[model samples]
Target: MLPLTRDQKHLVDQILAFTTDHVNETGPAVFTVYGDAGTGKSVILAHLFNQLQTAARTQPNSPLTQTTNYFLVNHPEILKVYREIAGQAPHLLKKDFQRPTTLINQLAKGQTTADVLVIDEAHLLLSQSDHYNNFYGDNQLRSLLTAAKVIILVFDETQVLRMKSYWTEERLERLLMPYPHQHVRLTHQFRMQASDALVTWINDFTHGHVHHLPKDIGTHYDLRIFNDAEQMRQTIVAKNNQVGLSRIVSTSGYPSTLDGGKHYITEGHFHLPWDQYNYTSTPWAELPQTIDEVGSIYTCQGFDLNYVGLILGPPLTLSPQDQLEVHLDRYTDVEAFKRRADITDKQELIAVKKQLILNAVNVLMKRGVQGLYIYAHDAHLRQFLGAK
Candidate 1:
């Protein structure tokens, strides 16, 4: 279960008020919660959603009573966690939690409209039609707004990972221009135990700015650069054994395909299969056996870990000028950079691909709550990070 901070609790109350005001409005109403990864965005949504359901089901005097609501997440892994939590709550039903695509398709079939729809990972909602996912709508959020009275969503532009689902503040605002909307940005780093300086170091590094590692950085966080990949894996295993929820994750340079076969990440006699498509209810990071597999951005995003061993893959390298360089050809995730007709400029498309790669790096780095371990496939980059 997720716990809300004092500020998060207040935010929930504010969102509840926003929902109450917009419940009776004729057009679509939007309340967006903006925060970087680990600022307790999801926790606020959890509490707010629970309150909505409770007031709707148990309090006849409440305006929310008799309201039909739904909780949506585009990520299947996160959706599984929500549904599992719903199974234990008397006020929330498993059916109340669904993928955005699933809900959009259902509403398109002339199903009952939702009085309130709460969306998590709103950045993952498709901006363009994805026939593979069975979402042929022009835009998922637009379709949802048409089908729901009030929509509350959480978004972080840095978490936008695909060309199809790509979003920025400007893009989102342009879409919400016609709707009655309210938004707030949360700045605290709730997920990482590290100091602000450390967080800045991470942000800078992902942005291709390499600075010397801070001398006092290890005071609160266990930040380490490993010279050997196998040694790093061993250390992560030890961390998992001691405290649990630690896993080795990597960026997308290795050989990966949609084929139902295993591909291995081989580094200095250390070999592990890429994370398998999880068919079970458990999140990938929580499973004990996942330690033997190398996780990618897909399975590990939106989850927290006690320790993260991140392998900066081959696509990421150090330039002769000592800056970070991302080689697009080395990136194996073709689906992430798929061509979109709207993106006609070649340089703009290339820049977006590189930024998405950096975004993946940012996501993996922030997953560790207590510690972060690093191993780079590029020797110069590893040597630079390992420098005293």
Candidate 2:
């Protein structure tokens, strides 16, 4: 059973009431629920799914029956789990189910004319762009809209990472303009401590604006900064032993200053080099290995853990200028063009990268339920916390 936060329960009630009222009166409509990462957005989706399933089971044989289908839309991680449950090879399932066209067609044929299409991670929907094209033309949201009477998309625009065309207010408006759309902004964060501070900081850093939350209502975790990786790892080990707190190391697969020891957990059990670019493969042995540990943050996104130890590597720096220097090479695929791009100036690129890295770090830091231990490799960056 999935646990629902108070806000999530409220959102589910709203969705159920809306669906009940509009089950008979709709050709097509879109409902968008947007929030930051680790904000219980997915829990709301899960609760809605449960409600819809119950309605389908209990309702009489009526045309207004609920035909609900849930998809996390193109998340490789979720897809792997789904394949395992179906007893199919991951590669085979990828070939069959990875393409939106194939999956949608299969869903259409198998399902009983879906009344609601719930799409998680909807921020990945590509905007109108020529340089970068979604395999399905136009937008995936539009395609899903064609198939379902009520299309519900849940995503955080701020969490978009790999898409060529970033999601913006203008782009969202344009996409839903043709249809009757209602936008629901989720402001209450039940997951993170210091929610207001984190949200305000991230919004200002990325969008050049600030939006405030009501109050910081959750538990607070200590944000510790360390200059050396060895100290950080030792601290993590000690913390685990002292408090019996579950802990895991989350890094971008880079060696710390501790004599070339890798700080981050890799994907599989194949013993690949730490510097290897590809980190996608997962062996059967590694599956259990992941389960045994305290749970690493790199793989813990879209899920929750009791405690998290985040090792912010050299790519992140909080400088004396009160500016963040984030190196994008750790998280993005644009490393190849860095050599020749007009914006080749390292300082300028570092500034941009700093903001990006800070946002990502903030998201990761907020994922813990009980505690967060931050280990900063750069001493200058450590000073920014100011005795936190």
Candidate 3:
């Protein structure tokens, strides 16, 4: 069973009730659930989905009898995690859940249909087609909503990580403007075990905003700043040895590639490799060797970690004015923005391009549940954070 907070449970109940009441209504019904990174938005959705599935199968004349659920998740890691939960021994959620690319192809070919659309991590939905141009004409969210009778989106606009698919809250709102929609808010931090004060402080810290920190910062939360990457890795290894689930995440200083040859990620005296490739059936975090591999935002996003050791790359460094700047050139995540490379002169794309990179960095910073350790590649940032 999926666990949910009081507010989350109530929101799930309301959404289910509203969805059941409008099972046969004309047009499409839309509702949104917004929450911070770890407010149990996906967990609630999972619980409600299981219940509805059970009702449709075992219960006679159930309101959900006509309701068919087609679950969509844009992020691959998150998609697999949900599938693992829904399918235990055989580990198959093939019929109910889908990846965006797969769904788009099926929808284009008229191979599938559903009465209700369930989307998790919907903020990762792509506004534009990918490099292969597989979904050139299909705006995913709009297409999914139009295909179903009712659509439910669990989203956090701040988590948008790619230039190809980054849709702002305003954009999503505009899309739903024509439909009657209800909004729900989730305001709890269940992923991180740290005190509320510490989570708030880390949020403020990542944004470059000021946050008053208590003198006893390390008492409740195991937050720390390390001067070197090696020490940071060792500390995380020790933490994992004790409690497990510790991992290291880094910015684009170490480029990731799929050339198929083993390549080690080396910086000065510190050396490690990128994670081994993982299929949809296996997650990198679940493997023991994953600790020796450095994870990027794409791999680590939307997942909880016992402790996080983040290596700040040059892209995230102090400007001459002492204000922090996110340098695009220093961010080696060109694979993510390769689709936008041809449109160099487009002003709007360039503006959001930087914001998307920063958003990825923000995700890694907020991933730790128990503690967050830091390792800065830039000398200035190293000194700056070490002072904290």
Candidate 4:
């Protein structure tokens, strides 16, 4: 078992105290665990759940004896599948899996009575304005709080990807002020190399704060920025084959054309290739032939590998005034158009976009145990890396 970090242990103790105290009083307790992406929020929750399960089994009358339900608000389809497997009534799953209102209503119905409700991706519950008409109704965080005796919401407000209404710290505090809750924060990062300067740079750029790490005590990462696509491809292939490292390519625009030779010959993989461009797949696979086969930044967020090669597509160009415009356009749907429209200032939008790219880059960079290879088309970005 991986030893829990100090923050993790503190979180667990707090949860235990909250649960025990609430159960003794026969009341509900709301707890929010906030942290940045890759801060091991889910891991801590899982560990706590396991401990609660063990305690429930050993002491049947324990306050944590209420059925534990762990739900991720991001993917509703998976929840549907789980409901089916659990033999739950169809109506139970109808509660807007994405919305806090639906979740609260469902929990209140007593069909799924959970003593401890663990909500992952709680950042998805920004505010009333942050939601779509089809999903969240009224307030999501407030609705979720109404559901369970011990509600554990794990999220990072700074990592809010989709903006319904603009969110600020003042707004978030007001939203949570009504609840009798304890706010716990996790700071230690177990995944990244302690000495990694890029991690510091990216975090500082994104959050406007610096996260200090020990000097590269372990394997130092090599940063390479390239402008030529072919040259970048060649370098990634050589690195992957020679060192058995995984390669990832990120693009803002779907490639209009894909080189078949590079797709099959190179061991490195691409992210969301099918979504970006048209490609023919080989006989063995059902999906189109694209770098998405290797992995995507979304799929690989909390994961780590021996090596990572990142390719930034056109959207990441230094010249684009609306840097995050491409990212928001690519990730969200048409319904989110109004939210994007609210972003009026080009420079502010570009700054947000830059932060988004830096976050994505941070995600890719931390994946490598020993090395990171970057291929960027933007000349400014290349210059930033001091690449030849």
Best by lDDT: 1
Of 1 and 2, the candidate ranking higher by TM-score: 1
User: What does candidate 2's lDDT look like per residue over 179-232, in tens digits?
Assistant: 877778887766656546654654564443323322442346444545444545
What lDDT does model 3 reach?
0.75
Among all windows of 10 consecutive residues in model 2, the one with the lowest summed lDDT is 269-278
Candidate 1 structure quality by residue, lDDT tens digits, 247-318: 999999998998999999999977999999999999988887899999998999899999999999999999
Taken over the whole model, the C-alpha lDDT of each candidate is: 0.90, 0.53, 0.75, 0.52
For model 3, how does the per-residue alpha-carbon lDDT over 1-388 read when each residue is reduced to its tens digit? Answer: 4567677678888998877876678758888999878788888888777766776666778887746677788878877787777676232255788887677678778897677777888888877666474776446887776677788888887688777776778888999999878888887777777677766666665565533454555454677878767878899999989889899988775666678765566657678887666764767677788989888787888888889988877777775556667677776676667465435677776667666766776788778888889877777766766534
Question: What residue runs in model 2 are displaced by over 4 Å at the alpha carbon?
Answer: 2-7, 23-26, 61-68, 78-102, 105-113, 126-138, 193-220, 237-288, 291-298, 328-358, 386-388
Tell me the deviation in Å of residue 291 in model 3.
1.0
Pairs in clash, predicted candidate 1? none
Question: lDDT at 132 for candidate 2?
Answer: 32
What are the per-model C-alpha RMSD values against the true structure? 1.2, 7.6, 2.7, 7.5
Could you say which candidate leads in TM-score?
1
lDDT of 2 at 238: 65
Model 2 / residue 254 / CA error / Å: 3.9
Q: Which ten residues in a row have the lowest lDDT in candidate 4?
A: 277-286
